[model samples]
Target: MTVLDPAMVPPRDARAAFRDGLVTPTAGWSAGWAQANLLALPKDRAYDFLLFAQRNPKACPVLDVTEPGEISASIFDGDLRTDLPAYRVYEHGEQVAEVGDVRDHWRDDLVCFLIGCSFTFEAALLDAGVPVRHLERKSNVPMYRTNRACRPAGTLSGPLVVSMRPVPPELVATAVRVTSRYPAVHGAPVHVGDPAALGVADLGRPDYGDPVEVRPGEIPVFWACGVTPQAAVAASRPPFAIGHAPGHMAITDVRDSAYAVP
Candidate 1:
């Protein structure tokens, strides 16, 4: 088990680790703070990207958008280039490289978008007595690309992506209630059993993150993922793009409650 130091519990401490070139996954970092997925493309196509996210609200819930060339969000108060654990640079829709920092790839014409992540509901889940198996197992939550298609907008379209958790049967209802309060962060599970229904053939082999064990009495619950933007970037083949590597998210300074509803 990787025992994190007490100093690492703060959001600033986590960001410092990334600044110091840490390439590990961002899950479990700054637990109460919201974590976001990132997407960057050229300024000209920014409208298309915005329209796409608006059209596919489930997978691409908008959290924050940046003006062209800006690297920091008012909510996070940090430079995106150095704050994330890893960045995936895509060129012509193909992932060209995954780097610890994106300073070299940053361009004046690029616009960054921050999307709400399922991690926002994690603290609430645990508080409500729901187990986050990935945290217990010390692994990143599993993610899959479903056959379900997202509504297309100009220059962006792809299959829906989902993040999975193994929820105990008894806590299923509680889980839904706890997460549904955070609509910006994917709200609730879209599918809860039968992975094949989402075109996921094997839960053991996920498209992203680590596989977690589903207890005998547990059902696999799937939530719309922020990573779906990356899938759209892949399918659309934008001339230039950058995104947080799977499981490595932008740990924002905002509180989870900031996006939650009564």
Candidate 2:
């Protein structure tokens, strides 16, 4: 069994995971700072992917786009190719490799995207006095594929993916209010209440991440997740692609308060 040592985890400024030799999942690190889901595409497909994200804003909210061969993003001032703690490289739709850095794979024709993630909203939920079960358990949030379809853009389209959080019925309203303030990072819950309504059959089983107990008096709340893009990219099977390993998001210098819309 591999034990994760918090002390061994690299600091937020270390840049790429390869720099710090971190190849583990990213959860519970970089508590208050905003983290982003990563997507890298060949320059030929960059325009199409960008339009797709624009067409389906809920699932693919764009935070920043980096020029080909450039690893840093405008919003965060960090290198996309080296900043993430870990990366998943995909080729023609199938995941070909997982690495700590993409510097070796970097190409002048590749464009990088840094999209919003649910971690930002999770922080707001905690601040609002709403319970976040996964945080309490020190585990990744449960994620599922919903029957709901995202609006198609070019070759990018797929069923929406959602992250689940079991909140008390009384605090559901509070969760919405707090999360709604940050639209760049997944915003608010897309579905609240029953999981089956979204065609999710089993609460114990999730397509991604770990499942947690939904205690009495609590309801499962689901939000559109950054993983949705990963699923789309997987299905599209681009010749070459890269993304942050799930939960190992790219920490940005941009403050979360900047995203809070009045």
Candidate 3:
């Protein structure tokens, strides 16, 4: 079996592949396009989750939102129930299913939110010569739940989640500079060096996604992750919800440059 080079595929084609049952982390997929985190909740809980996102912008930078029962967004025309590489179903905060399609569980009252993903900035990081270890290793970017708590919003609260990338010592500043230009996608490093400060006791064991080698002398830099919403779902335990599996993102039609700052 041959795997497509996601980095070289077009966003629409990438999504089509996903709909066709192709499963892979989207880090380098559709190189110049923005990717988004997926969160679908019932109409009754939408307002609370929206407020949670507003109160925690860094970890939940929303790119687009769908009307209740709508399966597509302006920036994401693909079918929300089947276009992503994978989906997670949660009930009362406990994850109950991880599947490639959600149409079986889709509800008419579900409202979908598309949050900006750091993968939107990885192309920029590579262009600037910063190493993205997960991409190099053909693995998922590691994510951790931090001791830091996000601001609570109307029945929702959880610890902030962060994605980790290892950069060479000399390129740390460059990585920060490039990523800062994309605030819509969790811009800049929220914490760099000493994972202990974030309460990450082990680098090889991540709360979400797979761990990649940090390499000698490379420092692990942390960025606010869109997965924070899923963490919120687990903590707040609303009656029900659906989200994309970590690292398995919805490759949006929007270009990454759309989120870049001057």
Candidate 4:
């Protein structure tokens, strides 16, 4: 893994930390920016996936879609193949490779989808004085695939994947109000207080990301996550799919304010 120079990390460029060799995690970089989860699929499956997102807006809010063979993301002034520090290439449900860029693997028929990311709401939570533990610890927010079934479109269907944060019971309401402003990014809590409600048997053992402590007064708050789409894609096991490695997102030029509700 490439180690990053913290001194050189840019505040807004999503790929800056990766460029500086900061491979640790992105929970804290670019404080108030919107981060995006990516989905690249073969042209043959693009329309189906787009419809899937439309039907499941909370889990797959569409940010942008790219024409086949193009890497430039107009929303972020970025090249999709290089902006994200890491990419996971999956072929038929099996992970084929994890690499820094996808240029070598690029195909003329590939279409890219930029989905809303949870990081976009962290700023609001912080402003409301709700502590985001993962950001404080510089760790990726914990994510899990739950028993909740997503409304299927075509062959895309799977349980929802959620990101969890521990919020003090007293501040739970405030956290909800703050996050609800960004509907484009899996807004608000999907569940709170009980892991069993979401089929999460163990908080310490997550399907993705490291776990953190849930203090005496804290409740485990869960939010709909972009990972849901990836889980759906993985389950379907199309001929090929590519996504950003967890915590590493596609940073768009669009400001978080652009997605916030008044």
Candidate 5:
């Protein structure tokens, strides 16, 4: 048997667990469908944040955005306030609370942005015979904050974030080629061999998510992450912000193939 089951998991099944307060990180579920990283902010700051995403496509590729007071996305048809496994509340650049749902924090003037996530590519990797160490070890994908600075857009600016996976040397090229086809989902590895090039000091202590062992003969591959916007939230210190807890993403109805390039 494989590390993770290859069968497609319906998005609603995962959403139901999240709505019921089962706050599990969404690394292995809802295969084949796309997963999203959510960022909700007040309408007043939406433009700046949108501009920031446009400037840093690799880290913040946008998939959908919701109108003020809207709870569902038109593109995917899921509850923004409750679909994700966990939500985070940030105030003045600091994470203040983590909750199972954000119903109490909902506001009419808030605009929600759904950013592309790296998890969308995991299904493809597993199908192509790539071993995802985290899935094999039943741990969250390790992510690190990089020293690289994303170009500033309006008031948002911060370091890039990356998700790490250990790939066998023989399959590294296949991993890159398969994932490169999906540009909308944090496409391809930004760095393949060394974490130090991105200023990541240690793989064991990630800024977000849990660490998995990198077995010998497997090289760590880093991909640009949707969490990059979280760094901006830390730096800009927006008065009020909400996001999916790292690794706890919103499963979308959209298929992963829809985001893949020719």
Candidate 6:
């Protein structure tokens, strides 16, 4: 079979590759489609997380949610258990396994939440002449867990996580403007200039995903990340939970334009 370019493949085919056991970051795949971070929690804890996501909208902009026990959503037409390139399974806040398929660990009471991913806005950024360094390097976007804490909801709370992209200083404004239009996919950058301001001590060391080079004259821009929920799962110690591995997102059928604003 001829391998389709990641940018040219449609969402369904992108998901099909993942289902076929491909394990790779979704950042540059299915270019014009929206990607999502997945969080599957037992029905018993659903309402608490719903409130948690509601309270932390910037880090957890929800796009679609599946009813308890369901594998598909309105925006994502693929199998939730098998379509994502990788999954992190947590037990009492401890990640016990990372796998390509979660069917063995799946629970019938799981309620899946699909949170918007910044990858959805990357094509727009590239279109606007801003560079996404990780894409160029063929690596996962760097993610850091901040010292800042999210507002607590019921029993759920954790530090905010941010994804870093090195934008050329001259195009920083364009990067901001392009991304801000997509509010659901973590619109705009939360921090720019100094990573120290967000308590990130070292740009070379990230809490999740691989670190990339920040070229001379390029500013490291930070955006709120959907991986925040997984951080919550670790901190809050939920008995059982599942999340997309950082940078391994669900490629939904929804178009990027659906979440963009004027």
Off by over 4 Å in 6: 1-3
Q: How many clashes does each candidate structure show, in the order listed? A: 0, 4, 0, 3, 0, 0
Q: What is the C-alpha lDDT of each candidate?
A: 0.90, 0.80, 0.94, 0.83, 0.90, 0.95
Among these predictions, the greatest lDDT belongs to 6
The true-versus-predicted C-alpha distance at residue 77 of model 4, in Å, is 1.0
lDDT of 4 by residue, 152-216 (tens): 88978888999999999899999989988899998878898889989999999999888888888
Candidate rank order under lDDT: 6, 3, 5, 1, 4, 2
Q: Candidate 3: which stretches are off by over 4 Å? A: 1-3
Model 4 RMSD in angstroms: 2.6
What is the C-alpha lDDT profile of model 6 across 1-262, one tens digit per residue? 9866899999998899899999999889999999999999999998989999999999999888899999999999899999999999999999999999999999999999999999999999999988899999989999999988998898899999999999888899999899999999999999998999899999999999999999888899999999999999999999999999999999999999999998
**Candidate 3 per-residue lDDT over residues 1-262, each given as its tens digit:** 9866778999889889999999989988899999999999999999998999999999999889899999999999889999999999999999999999999999999999999999999999999988788988888999999999999999899999999999898999999999999999999999999999999999999999998888889899999999999999999999999999999999998999999999
Query: Lowest-scoring 10 consecutive residues by lDDT in candidate 5?
Result: 1-10
Residue 226 lDDT, candidate 3, scale 0-100: 97
lDDT of 3 at 138: 82
* Candidate 5: C-alpha RMSD after superposition: 2.5
How many clashing pairs in candidate 4?
Answer: 3
* Candidate 2 vs. true structure, TM-score: 0.91
TM match of model 1 to true structure: 0.97
Q: For model 1, what is the alpha-carbon lDDT of residue 233?
A: 87
> For model 1, how does the per-residue alpha-carbon lDDT over 131-192 read when each residue is reduced to its tens digit?
99988776789999999999999888998999999999999999999988998999988998
Q: What lDDT score goes with residue 204 in model 4? A: 93
lDDT of each residue in 1-262, candidate 2, tens digit only: 9865542343454354435676544555555666688988888888888988997787788988887878677766666777777888888888887888788888888888889887876666777899888878878788998999887778777789998999889998998899888889888889999898999999899888889999998999998888888888887777888888777778776666777788
* Model 3: residue 154 alpha-carbon error in angstroms: 0.4
